[model samples]
Each structure stands twice: as structure tokens, then as C-alpha cells.
Target chain A: MERLLFDLSIAIERGKENETSPYPPDLKGKPGAYEFTSRLLEMNCPPDTILKQGMMPGMDRIGKKFADGIVFIPEILIAAKAMKAAMTLLKPYFDNGAVLRKGKVIIGTVAGDLHDIGKNIVCMVLEGAGWEVFDLGVDVTKEKFLASLNEHPESIICMSALLTTTMREMEKSVTTIKQAFPQTKIYLGGAPLTSDFADKIGADGYFPDPHSLSKHLTGNL
Target chain B: MINKTFRFSTESLLPDISLILIEMGYSIPLADHYLSDLINDTLQQVRKHTRVQAGFIMLPKDSIKTQSNILFENRLLFEPGSIIMSQLQNVTSLAVFLATLGSDFDLWIKFVQQIDMLQAFVIDTIGSLMVEKAVDLLEEQISMQAMIRAEKCTNRFSPGYCQWLVDEQHQLFHLLPADFDWVKLQPSCLMTPLKSISGIIGLGKNVIKIPYHCAFCDNKSCYRRLKNRKGQ
Candidate 1:
């Protein structure tokens, strides 16, 4: 079981979505995360175990590589796409509560920023890490975040911005949410934001990559 | 509220070299026309003998003061406000030398036209790859350095954020080395390199540095904060 899980993780990391998908060119014509994950389910391997051990670890590697600059956006995006493809098979388990989530995270690109690449990457990594992510998408408003929080009181909030102009939206949202719910932890990121900026805005934390964020959340939980 | 810093160094000269290549009519793939204009401006003013070196440092919020100055001499984008201020420091002695190189209006015009042509060709092929590579190199270097220093650095932050006021450009400029004569920050706080970067990094021991969510922050009216908290 462990060996199969490791194989699936390697597939996801290499961006092998399925046997027919041709990516990472070197792995062409080989079974990918999709086939492996489906096979694991057919074999009655628990979905929770598969997600926790297989998909999460693969995402963790991709996130660390991204943070270390060992990989760029294109590579990370491919890995994320592969992970998402595998995730579709497990969605039913999640809905049925057979695969319990670590927690909920509300994520989005703050307002005035149309950029979604970074936000999408984080969302995928967090999902792979076993968190239920409520993606608010680009140009998210504070009201939407608050409403989401109201609906999912246990959810953690994350904000992203690629433009300097939109970074202010991240700060505004953090400040508003913290005031309303002081206990809620907020995570902020993007090309233009720093931990200093996050601190200045009184956010709970700031991380450069999703792997570090996932690890931090996992340890805390 | 964890403060951290990470730094690393690599022997990549691609960014600086690419700048020179663009000046010599070597087309940069995927670059927008405006980027070429920005690069041409730097090429014209840079000294011939000077070389460019760049570094980034992210400080704690309390370490830096935020302030704003009027841009365009009088045109206000909104009420004059302070956004997060980040500094991009470049040492360009050659740039200064090039600036002193006697100006030839005709040559300059022709150079501009060449850059326009290159931009048209490269935008589709490599809009920001060259510049992105440069930033990536610097980021990797700084991150490794920070890690060696035992400080976990978060991602780079630039000016125009919530707490760090864009108006604090002068303060960041103060931290820059005095030797780089070619590059200058205008009243609007724009860097001459056009390819140069300015941002902040948090230095500390913690692994995860949480950012304050703008939606929950009390500074609701911060001009730099994004207006849409929820999706439109």
C-alpha cells in the first residue's frame, strides 16, 4: 500500500495525469496519478490515507521546489493540474465524509487584482494537503470573505495579490476580518506582499509558498 | 506575527546581460513595448564602464516608516496616502558613464524604434521571461542567504501595499548605495532600470509567517488595500 501511494505521489509530482496524458515528456505513455488513484480506490485503499500520504506529499514537494526556486510557475502549474485530475476521483469520498478534511481555508485574489495564477496554485496545494478550500476567485471583496466565514465558521482565510495596487486590498481584508473575528487566523501572499506588509496590516501570518503554509497549518492543527 | 528572512545567491548574470543585449538590438522574447522603452531609457543614461548589481531586503513593519509625496508635481491619483514602501537598489556606475556619453538624438530615436520592433516580436514569444529570470535569480540568492543566516524569509514585497506607503520611496532610496549614479527614483518613485525590483522581506525564526487579512483589518479605508474583498 505504501509503495503504491509513493508511486502515485511521484506521478503527481512529475505531472503525469494519466496514461494518455503527455507531460514531463519523459513520462509519456505511463500510467499517472489518475490511473493510480482510481486503482487504489478499486483496491479499497482508504481515500483519507491516499490523500494524506500520496497526494499531500507530492504537493508538498512541488511547493517546496517552488519556494526554493528549483521550479518555476509553469512546472508548478503542471503539477497542480495533475493533482487536480487525481482529486476528481476522490471528491465523492470528501462529500461523503469518508475523507475528513484538516480544516477549511477561504482563499482568493484580493480586489483590483485580476491575477489568479498564484491564488490557484495555493488553492491546489492546500486542497492536496487535506484542507477544504473555499476559493473566492479573483477580485474578491471583504463582504464575500465575511459571508464565507459566516457560512463556514471554522474556515481560515487566505488572500493573494499580484499587483502592488491590489495588495492594499489584502491588507484591508485582513484588518476588517481580524477586527470582526479576532481569533481567526489570516494568511496573505502574492508577488507584491512581504511579511512586513502583512505585519503592518496586523495579519496572522505570511508565507512565500504553499508548502510552508500547509506545513505550518498542519503542525498547528 | 512571525518575522523571518531567507537569502540565497546564484551566479546568474542573465538579467544584467539581457539588458545589454536589448540595447545592442538582441531581441528579448516576451517583452512588452513599454518594457523596452523602460530598458532604453536606462541604456541611454547608464555609464559605459559601470556594472549593475541588485539586492532585496524585507524589513519588519515597525522598522520602516511609511510616507507619501505628491507625484506629477501636482496630480493626485487619490488623496495623498502612504502605501507599503519597498526599495530596489541598483549600482550602475557604467550607466552613469553611458549617460555622460554624448547624446545623439538621432541614435536615440533609432534605438527607440529598434526597441519597438523587438517588443512587437518578443511580446508573444517571451513577454517577461528575461525580466522574470533576473528577479528569480535575485530571489534565489536572497533566499539562500537568508537561510544561511538562519532567518526564514518570506516572499518579496514591494511598494504600494497596505502598511508600507509608496510615498516612503525616499526612505528606501536612502538605504541604497550612493555609487550607482545612473539609476534614479523620480518623484513618483519609479526606478530608471524599469527592470529593477524593489521589495521587502521578513526575517525571523518561524517557518510560517501569517499575513493579516485585509478584509478583517481595522484599517478599512487604506487606499492601498484592494477594494474587492469578495469576487465581483
Candidate 2:
């Protein structure tokens, strides 16, 4: 049973989806995450164990590789793909309180920046790391962020923007939100921002990559 | 926004994952083959579903200045205000433009949600690459047009680059021809295609040579800036 869990982790790390998935050719005909996860559940393995042991570690390994530049976005994407496949079967258990989330986060792209890849990647990494993320979609305004923040006061607020154009919006949103909820910790992520910018914006943290953000979520930041 | 029916050009370039990875600081040889294949597959999927359209209009040089969110035909008015775009003293004209990978890409992203999130991410990255390529193509074509006028073109500068504010995006979009179905801009300046871009290009003789694009920006962790700093 332990070996099966290990196999599940390996399959996820390799991005092998199932027997028919052409990815990682060596695992081509072998059972992928889908098959392994189903089998593990059938074995009466605890849902949390499958997630913590099987998916999280696999995602954690890849997440580290990704942050260190040992892996690229595509590899991260595939790994995320595999992990999500397994997570789908585990969702019911999670919803039923059989498993507990690491924490919760409210994240979005600040208004005027319609980009979402960065947000999507960050959310995926966070969720894989065991956080429940409330994703506020693109062009999200400051009011929207405040609304979500008010509703999920326990959730960390993470804002993202891809363009320098929208940095002002990010700054504006942060300033307003910080003033209104000075106790709420805010984090900023984007392609055109720096730690200095985060400091300037009065943010609690600046995650250079989703891995670091995950670490922050895990209290490692 | 300067309205005009001036001539321009449009083109598209597919994303190259190998090169994209290199930009992300991964040497070509160090790139994972499986990952490369997956990104390429995602690009192909986006390409299959994408309808790319990008074009730029070359407005004749005018007295350009800005005041109260308005360019005085010669003023360097910033979108969010107080950004010196650059030395446009000799900028005889501006190439206002728009580019998009189309709504199909948006539909594809939404569709991928029910399928796979990772693939969706890849597709999203591909769309961004497409928009960049489209802008690159637009700038190149604009440069050629400048050459025909016996003028040199400054490196393309968008509404939010350097000192320009993103708030100026709507102003630039209003200059494109009516019925320009390719891309649409919102009151907030967000483009519809999600992978769309709109900005200005300086065309002239001896327009100020731009310093490295990194000098004026704050995103110190950008891969482009990182690669540039590493002397790549």
C-alpha cells in the first residue's frame, strides 16, 4: 500500500495521466494518477494520506524544481495536471471534512490588468500545497478584493498584475485595502514588480515565485 | 487619441518553448524534453484555435505634449500621470496599435477549465507569447515603414512602458479604425482577447535612443531583465 502511494507520487511527478497518456513514454501503458488514485481510495487509504503523501509531495518536488529553474512552466503544468487528476477523486472527501486544508487565500489580478496566467499558476501551486483558494477573476477591482477579503477574513490577500501599466491599480488597491483593514496581511506578485515595490505598497510580502508563496503559506516565509 | 486611417501592418509568430524557457533562465540543453513537448503541444492547440490580428497606424508627426490627461499634439501626457515616456523631441509620428489572439483563445481557456488546469495554463502562456510576437511583428513592420520615409524608428514603447501609464491604453485604442474587429478596448483599457496589446511607437529621425527597457521599470525579477543582466 505504501508502495502504491509512492507510485502515485512518481506518476504525478512524471505527469503520467493514465495508461493511455503519451507523456513520459516509459509510463505510457502503465496506470497513471487517475488509476493509482482510484486504486488507493479502493484500498481504504485515508483521503488525507493520499493527498499529503501522494499529491502534495509530488507537487512539492515539482514546485521546488520550478522555483529553482530546474523545471519550466510546462513541466509544472503537467505536474499540476497529474495532481489535479488525483485531487478530483479526493474532493468529496475534502468537502466532507475528512481532510483539512492548510489555509485559505483570496487572490486576483488587480483591475485594468486582464492577465490570469500568473494568478492561475500561483493558485494551483497554493492549492497543491494544501490551501483553499478563492480566485477572484481578471480585471478585479479594489472593491471586489475588499469584498472577498471581508468575506474570507482568514484568507490571505494576494494580488497579481502582469503589466507595468496596471501596477498603479495594484498600488491603489493595496493602499486602500491596507488602510481599511490594516491588520489584513497583503501579498503582491507580478512580472513587473519587485520586493521594493511591495515594500513601497505596504504589502506584508512579495513572492518571487509560487513556490516561495507556498512556503509562505506553510509558515516558512 | 489621434484618429486616422493611416496604413500599417499585421502579423503573427508561434511560441517557441525552447526559446521561451531560455528566457526563463533555463539553458536550451537544460530544458526538460517532456516539458518542451507539452508546451509545444499547448502552443499548437492555441494556434489551432486562435485567430491572430494585429495592426498599427502611423500618425504624421505633430506637436505632442500632454496636460490633464490630454496630449497637446506634442505633450508627453502619462496615463496615470507624471511619467516621462522618453525623449520624443524628434518623434515626428506615433504608431498607435492593437493586437489580439482573438476571443477563441478566451473560449479555449474557459473550455479547458472542465478539462485540465495545467493545459489551460500552457494555453494561457501561449496566448501571451502570441501577443508578444504580434507586437514584435508590428514594430518590425512599422520600422520598415519608417525606413521608407527615410526615418529611423525608436524601439516600440507601449502606454504603460517606462513612464507611460496603463490608463492611456483606452486613448491609444480610440485611434484605430472603426470596425477594426481584431481587438477591442474597455473603458478601463483592458483588451478583450486577453492576449491583446495596444501602445505607441515613435517614428522619426534621431528620436532618442532608449536605454535598456529595464532601467525605468521596478520588476527586478523579470526574466528578460534577468537574462539581460546575466549578459545573455
Candidate 3:
């Protein structure tokens, strides 16, 4: 096990952003993911190794914890924040193809739903797992989803709705997009949604949490 | 034609704001202190443009004649049901109100969305608590005014709850004074500032049970249920 990579993972897992960051207070004076990642890049460490070993494992652990109900939204949120700090350092490598992304994802909260917390968390974890995410934000419509998919032809769609009323829009978009692009997959999630509801609405998959979504993408894509 | 606006100070909300930190997994004393520091920093940044507004329109008892899908108010008629029938049976008039956490919160949400999602989530959680608390404070005033008249009323019932179709939000928005322009209702019936809330409270003869506030409700997202469960 690489010590530098291991340190980076610990920083992200415990949500240590930088040396000055007061969170995970036990680690107050220690270098955080930002410094560790930056230092690793300078040390000629492979960007892919840092992402695969340092970032992904930490995020995967937390995502699993999140799925198991051991860690709640706030904890997952803070961890995602830590992963993002390191991810910023790695983005240049992703662009230059030094470290390849797993694939592209289009995710959003559907139209008529203003809630973005669930959708945003999912996006962060997916991106941390090395996917290029196109976040469509809240109140996104089927046309926008479809258009985004066309732009990133390799992208899979993930729609989130936090309200029962807005969840119907998921079914509507699922029905419409499935008809037009029969092979394309659309995933559904949010508080009021269920796997049963997703199947009823013709969605290809259902994610109860972001880690599950990330796992599905890793295994499937 | 009674219209009023309110601004709730965040300082006055100190005690109640603990739940926001608690939900952020900061319940223990030391963690609570650390998270409180983080929250205050974010609150200061967010407060620069924080604009929370709550508006109310008090109507006379004779103003509303509700019929399942349609409500006849004065000379105007609007459709779809958000009006709780049981609550209306004993009231002299109803108070229709709207509360918004403002576009600045939305802007802050967007700002933090990219930079600091944890703070963004906390901000999101706090905005909700703030708007709901503001709404409750306003409702307390209405409840007291009704008490003075010796008239009891039901708990608020908003559109999109119970059998009330969300489409009726159009009708509810119609009842509010247009001069209360802090919040806007979209064609989709969703309000802007996203954290905004609107509902009707009937001045009647019975104490109505508020949904989500009930301990018996199985909803994990209900703040009251969470509060009661942990005694927060």
C-alpha cells in the first residue's frame, strides 16, 4: 500500500480538506487531501493511481456507509466535499487523458421539483468515481435530459425527484425517452421513489443512495 | 384585505437552530461547537443577501364558499382542492399566507453548490428551518388574534398535502395580495426561491392535527417526528 495514496484516502474519508480546515478536528494540523493530492502529483505519482487508490476507495467506503445507514447525509456531504478538493487537482489529468474517466453521466432533479440535495450528492460521488458528470440542476425537463444525452451520446441519464407530484414527471420522461431511444437507460431516485415505482415507470435502474448509483455505474459501465 | 410582512431575525432563532446542526451530524458538544462555527461562517456569507419574507392576507369568514374542486371567494372562483374541508366547518375566516427564504439563499445555494456542497446542504437545511420557523411565528400571531376573538382554528393545510392536488396552488396564490411580491408562483405551480411555503389556516371550532407533526406518522423526513424521537 502506497503511504502517500493512503494518507490522501484518509484525508478524504475523514473530510480533511486542507491543513487550515478545522473539521475532523483530530487531524487539525495534518496535511489534508488538497495538500496530499497536490504533493502526490508533484512526486510523479500516476494521476490514475491517485484517483483509483486514493479518491475512489475513500468515496466508495463512505458511499457504502451511506447505503448501510451508518453515515447520514451530512457526513456523506462532508466526505464528498473532501473528495472534490482532491478531484479539482486531478481534473487537468482527466482532460488530458492522463487519467481516463469511466464514462459520462447526465443527472438532475426533474421539473416541478426544487430539491437538489439528493441529486447533487449523487453527482459528487459519481464524479469522484471517475465519471464525467453533466449536472443539469433542478427543475430539468425531459427535453433537456434528452438533449443532454444527445450531446454526450455515451452518457446515461439519472433523474431525481423529491416530491410525489414531481415523481410523476419521472415516469413521463422515462416513457418518452424509452420510446425514442429504446436502448438508453434512465435511473430514478429521491425520497418518495421506490424500485417498484421505477419499474412501474419504465426506468432502467433505481438508486437508493449515491454510492449504490456509483457502484452500479462502475459494474455496468 | 389585511396584508402584513415579517422578518425573523436569525439571532432570535438560536435555540431552534440546533436541529440544523444536529441533522448535520454535529450533536455532541465539541462537534456542535465546531459545526456551529462553520454554520456561523456560512450564515454570515449567506446573510449578506438573506431576505426572508412572510406575507399574510386575512379574509372575512363569508369570503370563502368551497366546493371540493372549486373555491368561491368574494366574486371569484378557483379550481382544485387544497382547502381542508374539516377545518373550514367552524371558522369565521381563513388566513392564507406565504413564506419565502428569498433569492439570495438560492444564489448562495448555487454558489456553494460548486464550492462547498456540505455548507450548501447545511445552508439548504437552515433555509428550510428558517422559513418554516418564520411561518410558524406568523401563525402564532394569527392564532393569538383568533384567540382574542374567542374563535378557534385548525392547523394549516397546504396544497400538495392529503388529497389536495398541487394544481390548486394556483388558486391559493390567487387569494394572496398581489402586492406581496416576494415570492412568485410558476406555471408549474412551483414557487421560486424554492424554499418558499404557502398554506391556509382556518379559524374554526376544532384543534386540527398537522400532518408531519404527528408522532404517529412514519415519515423519516418529518422534523417533528425526528425531534420527538430524539427529544431534540
Candidate with top TM-score is 3
| TM-scores for all predictions | 0.54, 0.81, 0.86
lDDT tens per residue, model 1, B35-88: 345445444343331233454433322332222432222332222232222221
The lDDT of model 1 is: 0.60
lDDT of 1 by residue, A94-184 (tens): 9999999999999988875655556777887888888999998867888889989999988899998765656667778888898888899
Q: Rank the candidates by lDDT, best first.
A: 3, 2, 1
Candidate with better TM-score, 1 vs 2: 2
Complex DockQ per candidate = 0.02, 0.49, 0.46
Backbone clashes in model 2, listed as residue pairs: B61-B92, B63-B73, B63-B74, B64-B73, B64-B74, B64-B75, B65-B72, B65-B74, B65-B75, B66-B75
- Flag regions of model 3 displaced more than 4 Å: A38-45, B7-10, B13-17, B25-33, B45-47, B62-92, B206-212, B215-232
Better of 2 and 3 by DockQ: 2
Winning candidate number (lDDT): 3
Measured with C-alpha atoms, the lDDT of residue A118 in candidate 3 is 86
Model 2 chain A is weakest, by summed lDDT over 10 consecutive residues, at A69-78
Cα lDDT tens digits for candidate 3, A1-221: 39989988888888888888878878888899999999999999999999999999989888888787566777787788888889989888888999998988899899987888888889889988989999999889989888987788777889998766787788888888888778887898886677888888889888888888888888986
For model 1, the chain A TM-score is 0.96
What are the runs in model 2 whose C-alpha is more than 4 Å off?
A: A149-151, A175-182, B1-12, B15-26, B29-32, B35-48, B61-89, B179-182, B206-223, B227-231
lDDT of 2 by residue, A146-205 (tens): 988889887789999877767778889999898888888899998778889899878988
Local distance difference test scores for all models:
0.60, 0.74, 0.76
